[model samples]
Target: MDFAIGGMAAVCAGFFTNPLEVIKTRMQLQGELQKKNKQNIRYKNILHAGYQIVRHDGVLALQKGIVPALWVQLIMNGCRLGFYDYGLSRGYCNDKYGNVVFYKSVIVSGCGGVVGHYLSNPFYLIKTQLQSESAKAIAVGHQHHHKGTWKALSHIYFKEGVSTLAVIACAYVE
Candidate 1:
């Protein structure tokens, strides 16, 4: 119940925010770690980046990572909200007087968020990689030729091992 509602709400938010996310990813990846050169600039700004993606890859391009994005949001928010609600119900966030303790609530919610983030990190990695892919002319970042989220996950697991997944998640934090 709580999980479902939180997941659904996050999905809706993710759906609307994904395009901006796509734009942001591309912009960040463009000319990454390279010397600044005017010629290398493909996306001038958010609007231009969005326009270029639409012109070259169609409007749907803006939602390239929607599947993984939705999954990330659903899993992360579901666990987070569910855990928080469970804590509240169990009085884990309440003081001896039955008043909600601010520090206890923060700790409970933060733990939930951490758990959710850890579980969903793989999807987030896939989402960023997928969103980074674009037409060759407009492509930015190291393009990972992932067929889909599942394939990417499998490839990483099989080729890189389980530790790599954890490493990736940790690296994302830094």
Candidate 2:
């Protein structure tokens, strides 16, 4: 179905981009909230960051959050493409004359994306948390010691409660 195709495509894309994502996350967290001069620049730039991560944590480190990242992409894209297709089939993205309406299509696609994003927020949160983890010497941001994706999800649900997840997702939206 459209959902499966979309999800598979997203998973493929996520696999290729995950390393870059890992680098980006570490770079962003390296001197987070710190003033320019006061910040310790562990990751000089993208290449350096990638090098440092691999050197410290091994090649696999570049895929630190692959599991959750793939899950996020899969679920989000699946729902998004599926919903968009559904809307198209229902004529929600077409004018009365049966012509495709640009604005209507945009609205339907946006709605699908929003729904997908909302549904995948938890996986995204886990991905971010997991990706931020690194060897202490090269670690950046708040290092959450999540054993894995499922464990992280359970920890959040049991210890922090569902409301915590909602709040985090809402904060990202704003």
Candidate 3:
């Protein structure tokens, strides 16, 4: 029940923030001087990213990858919050009188969040790629070329191999 409620709340908020996520990804991808050492900034900041995304790609573009993002959020938050709750119930994360032990709670919550992140990494990867593909530097960009999430995952696993599972390792520090 706690997990479901938390997931529901997260889903509701996610609908509103998903567009910002798209804008953020695009913005992060922009202004990179990685190879040539020459900055080519397309968005000045959040406002500009929002404006440019709608102006150039239409308002619908803001919702790109939202489905996967929601799945990522739902599963991630559900698992994170749910497992935290589970730890409390199991007596591993709370004091004898039921007060949460700060360090234990943090460790439990972090473990749960990492579990969620690991499970959602593939979807998050797809979300990131779909959201950032529209960046101006397509020529050198490594954005997934697949048209759908399934294809993207399939391609990543087949071509990228164990590197795909390495996503879980990245989640450990989160």
Q: After superposition, how far is residue 96 of candidate 3 from its true place, in Å?
A: 3.1
lDDT of each: 0.90, 0.88, 0.77
lDDT of 2 at 98: 94
Worst 10 residues of 2 by lDDT: 30-39
lDDT for model 1, on a 0 to 1 scale? 0.90
Residue-level lDDT tens digits of model 1 in 1-174: 888999999999999999999999888877573455533788999999999999999999999999999999998899889888999999999989999999988888888788888888999999999999999898875689899999999999999999999998777545
Clashes of each: 0, 0, 0
lDDT of 3 by residue, 77-168 (tens): 99889988999989989898988899998898888888888887878878888887663433224556668777787877788786755764
lDDT of 3 at 133: 64
Model 2 has a clash total of 0
Please give the lDDT score at residue 99 for candidate 2.
90
Candidate 2 lDDT, tens digit per residue, 73-142? 9989998898888889999999999998999888988887887888788889999999989998887766
Q: Rank the candidates by TM-score, best first.
A: 2, 1, 3
Name the Cα RMSD for model 2: 1.5
Best by lDDT: 1
**Which 10 consecutive residues of model 3 have the lowest summed lDDT?**
135-144
Q: TM-scores of the models, in the given order?
A: 0.93, 0.94, 0.82
